[model samples]
Target: MLIGEVARRSGVSTRMLRHYDSLGLVRPTGRTVGGYREYSEEDIRRIFHVESLRSLGLSLRQISRALADPAFAPASLVGDLIRRTEERLKREQELLDRLRAVDASAPFDWRGVLRIVELLHGLGSPDAARRQQTVLTPAEDAPVPAEVLAEAVLAEADPYVAGALRWALARAGADGVASLAAGVRSEHAEIRRRAVRALAELPGDEATAALADALGDSDPAVHRHAALALGARGTTTAVPTLVRMIVEGTNDVEAAEVLGTLAADPERTDRLMSALAAELAAPTADSAVRIRLAQALAEMPATSAHGLLRQLAHDEDRAVAAIASALVRAAEQRPQG
Candidate 1:
């Protein structure tokens, strides 16, 4: 077939076919009597193969190596193409995300768009201090989006920068809650921990609910932090977690103090006392555990804890007995409620 016929049938543009010849990807198998390029059936087949490889995102140079070198492994080249395509896709996605974030602000003009892009770049900067400044004192005219702050908060590892991100995120309000909440469920332990910690600072029912969900996290650190934050928020749901913390001797003192403050509630009095008294009676309550529980019990109101204190005052464990005795003595001097 002549070059024109091959171009028509194979859908390979004549210019591109000439370029392919220059690169030796596919050369015409013969020359016509008039000296025009002519392609044999095999040459046409090679042209189709080159087009097929190009469809797989193979570069012209790679296609040349693939078609000419039998020793060239398609598997390795395809793997490389897959990786490069994935990288390109990732960049495109990031760019699309930036544009969407800018659009989300409903920017008034080019300047507004520019402000958001600049803020995003600052947040994503390699310098932690630059990120901190971007969040800590964002331009007054260019409001930072909550999702942006939440993303930065989840990714920041610098202690100071992370603190700033959380502070900014809280100011952004409940809008950031969903993003932070997603971070709470992340499989990466560090991200999950940071997510919950940031969520803990954010006020709103959404953040509180997220913290409550985190109470069941498999990581002890995550659950403990969530429980402490929840306890501070006066969420009754945190009671069981705080009790567990005391028993495990992890931040037992703080847990005990929060529990003490919680027990001041008349409704929680009975449940709180019962929880401590049961732990004291548990066979698993070793001396150290018993001592921590005894100290926690002392935090309860004198009226609520008096009977439990009396029982522990003469306990077989001297340290436990001593803590109960000292608190009982102190309770005696106070006026009855």
Candidate 2:
């Protein structure tokens, strides 16, 4: 076939075919009477081979080496092409993410677009201080979007930076709560914990409800954090988890304090004491678990707690007995409320 026919059949432009000829990548094997280039069947086959290799992202130089060098191995070259393709895909995905974030911000002009881009760059900065500063300073009164802040909060490792991000997300309001809620169900324990903590800081019925829902998380740490936060917010659903925190000795002190706060209601006070007493008396309760329960009783007011401590003072476990006895005696000697 002639160059034009080859280009038309192969979907390659005539100009590109001529360029390939100049590079000696594919040269026609015959000539017309007018001295124009003429392609033989073998030459057309080689052109198709070059085009096939090019489809796999092979450079023209690499293709020349591949076609010319009989000793060339394709394994390493193909591996390199795979790696380069992956890198290009990654860059393109990042560009798409940036564009989405800018569009999500609903930028009013080029200035707003630039500001969102700059803020996003700062939020994703490797330096913790830069991330914190990005949250601290709004972009000319344009607050960072809640979804962006929620994403950062879930991945942030630096405690200080994470706190700043949480505070900013809270100020961003309920917009980020749904994103953080997804993090609560994450397979990663750390991410689940971070999500609950961020949700705790965000003010709204939605944030509180999300935290309350997390009370049943399979990860004890997650449910415990959620329980504590919800306890502070007066969510009655956290009561059982709070009691479990005491028994397991995970943040039991804070758990006891929140329980004490929650126990002020006469109805809740009765339930709190009943749960403590039952745990102390349960057949599965070990000495350590019983001791933790005894100690937790000390955090509540003497009116509701001292009665239980007195009964526990006579318990079988000597350590549990001693701790309960001490708490009771101290409660008695203190000034009356």
Candidate 3:
């Protein structure tokens, strides 16, 4: 086959085949009488081999080395190709994400788009200060999209930056609720915790509802955070979880404080006290758990907790008895409302 025929059959252009000849990557096995390039069957096979390697993202130089050196091992080269491909994919994915974020912003014009783009760059900056500034620097007149801030909140690893992101999301109000709600179901506990914390700061019935739903999260820490946030919002659904935290000794003090706030309501006083008392009564309630329960009970309205405190003052555990006794004495000396 001649060069033209070879190019036509192999799908490689004649110009490219001449360039391959110049590089000695593939040479014609023979020439026509007019001295035009002629390709033999064996030469055509080599051209197909080169094309096959190129399909795997191999550079012409590397392919040359591969075809020329029988001793060359493909393991190292293939590994490099894999790494390069992964890096390219990562860059492409990031670009796609940025584009999606921009599109989601639905900016009014080129200026708003530029601001969001610039803000995204700052958020993605490697420096923690820059990321925080990105969240803070956006003027109130042009708020960054809530979804963008929500995504940053989930991804931020730096404590200060995460806090700033959360503050910003809170101001975004219900706009971020959908993005954050999706995050609540993340398989990752860290992400779920972040999402919950952000939801906690937001001021709206929607944010409150999202936090309430997170009470059923499988991760103890996730549900615990959600419980604390819900308690502050006076969502009674958090009651059982708050009591469980006291029993489990996870953030028991804060849990008790929130419970105390909840207990201030006349109707809920008896119910909240009962929940704590029930935990104290549970067979699994260990000495430490009872002590936590006793401490939590003390945070309630003194009248509500006074009876339980009196009973616990003489309990079997010395530590529980001492603490409860002190609380009982204090309750006794308290002024009447």
Query: Clash number for model 3?
Result: 0
Which portions of model 1 miss their true places by more than 4 Å?
Answer: 323-337
What lDDT would candidate 3 get against the real structure? 0.89
Runs with alpha carbons beyond 4 Å of true place in candidate 3: 139-141
lDDT of 2 at 332: 89
lDDT for each residue of candidate 2 in 128-208, tens digit (9 for 90 to 100): 898889889877645788888898899899999999998888777889998898998888989999999999888889888
lDDT of 3 by residue, 231-271 (tens): 99898999999998888888999999999999989989988
Could you say which candidate leads in TM-score?
3
Per-residue alpha-carbon lDDT of model 1 for 1-337, expressed as tens digits?
8878888998989899999988888888788899877898899889889999899998899888877788887888878888999999998988887887888788898998899999999988899889888888898888889888887788889999999988888887889888899999999989989999998898888899999989999999999999989988888889888999999999999999999888888998899888888888888988788778878877898888888888888989898789878888988987776
Instruction: Compare the candidates by lDDT and give the number of the best one.
Output: 3
lDDT of 2 at 337: 57
- RMSD for all candidates, in order, please: 2.3, 2.5, 1.9
Weakest ten-residue segment in model 1 by summed lDDT: 290-299
The TM-score of candidate 3 is: 0.93
Give the deviation of candidate 1 from the true structure as CA RMSD. Answer: 2.3
Model 1, total clashes: 0
